[model samples]
Target: MYIEFFVNVTSKAWALPILSSLHAGIPGRQATLLTATGASRTSFAQSMEHLIELGLLERNPGHGHPLRPEFRLTEFGKESAAIAHKINSVSQGEDQDLLRRAWTLPVLASLHTPGHFNDIRRSLLTITDRALSQSLKSMESRNWVHRSVNVDARPPRPIYSAINTGGRICQITAPEISFMQR
Candidate 1:
């Protein structure tokens, strides 16, 4: 669950700090903690690859070296981490007052309506419009939800619906379970 949470925020860019420490000489150090609090080598590599593809991270800037390029966060990568922190603070109940307000958000009760973007936005304690958009897109891509796009205007408006059709919005994906096995 924690890994999934970070995946949403860091989007693989979460591995930047670990990769940057390649030369630090800690051969078997745990880079990030999973929701279960277990750390493994495979998950770390996979996370690195995911972030690399997203362009949130890249090989170290130095051109010539025998060592693999160190990983570093792009500007966007930092922003992503910041946004994740804000969302997690509220969602994880780190802030009592914020969480209370978020619970009152209409989308929490009526997520079936495509027109509830504003409500969802308001419920999040500190997430930006961009993060909300990304979360919706990620949820839609994972088949947890469906997006209804309104193409009748200059900027498209998207409404979301549960893909499960039974109101299920969350599920453990195969990779998530696989990580646990490691």
Candidate 2:
């Protein structure tokens, strides 16, 4: 249930940053959030709309000009925002970019224990084969994940494990996320 919340909140690239910024006391105005997040206007707007749709955000009834409305976190959104804020606090500069991607954290959560490609896929459930492959490869290049061949297995499978910053993030999120285990 909590993993679903994380995955849903992260489906949009700018979503977590927007939520984290809100939680950090950055006023929930669109222009301010866009500037703070450094996201393009279009993507930022889309993400904002997505958050609203997900019931994480709402238009503040009496704030700002109509054309420049302010938003606020809903009860559920506040919970999610705290998690996002904690995760963001651990990363800085360039790492922020990677953390905002759709599958990164959820994938890292799946990698908390070393597993094969299929194991990760099964855990994420909604991730496609291509997306999982690409995410694993991307994390591997960053040394966030280490891949080793399991020669003892009949087919010499590749096992994936979160390491370094990725491992830290996995641990940070482990308490909230009870991901499906093989």
Candidate 3:
């Protein structure tokens, strides 16, 4: 359920950064959000429209000019923003890049405990094997995940575990799950 929420929220290229900016208390004006998130003018506008369409944000009809509107989070947006903030706080470089992709967070969360490929696949039921493999490879390259071989097993098997950085990402994101339960 939360994986679906994460994918929906991150569907737009600028969505995550915009949410992070809003959660950081940046003003909701178009110019402010664009500047704060460093999103291109076109991308910012499109993301704003997409967010409103998703019912995560709403314009304060009388607050600003139509061409430079102001927006505020709906109740749902607030919860989503909180999650974005938590994810953003723990990420850097490639990790941040990975978080913007759908299924990345779920994959990382599954690795909070060491797991083999099939173990993670079962945990994130909706992910494709190709997508999981790609995400894991990307994460390993970034050093967020460590892949080791278990040669002692019948046929050598690969094991994956979240390294310190990845574990911290999971730890930080844990609160977002608690928020959802509330």
- Say which candidate scores most in lDDT: 2
> Where does candidate 1 have its weakest 10-residue lDDT segment?
97-106
Model 2 TM-score?
0.92
lDDT of 1 by residue, 16-131 (tens): 33432322323222332332223255756676677667655565566324343355556655544343333333232232222122221122223544455776675454566776
What C-alpha lDDT values do all the predictions have? 0.43, 0.86, 0.80
lDDT of 3 by residue, 58-116 (tens): 99878998777789999989888877777787887555667667666778766767999
**Residue 81 CA displacement from its true place in model 2, Å:** 0.6
lDDT of 1 at 101: 29
User: How high is the lDDT of residue 18 in model 2?
Assistant: 94
**Runs off by more than 4 Å, candidate 1:** 1-38, 62-69, 93-182
| lDDT, residue 118, model 3 | 97
Q: In candidate 1, how many Å is residue 68 off? A: 7.3
Taking all chains together, each candidate's TM-score versus the true structure is: 0.33, 0.92, 0.84
> Compared with the true structure, what per-residue lDDT tens digits does model 2 show for residues 5-52?
668878999999999999999999988898899999999999999999
Clashing residue pairs in candidate 2, if any? Answer: none
Candidates 1 and 2 compared by TM-score, better number: 2
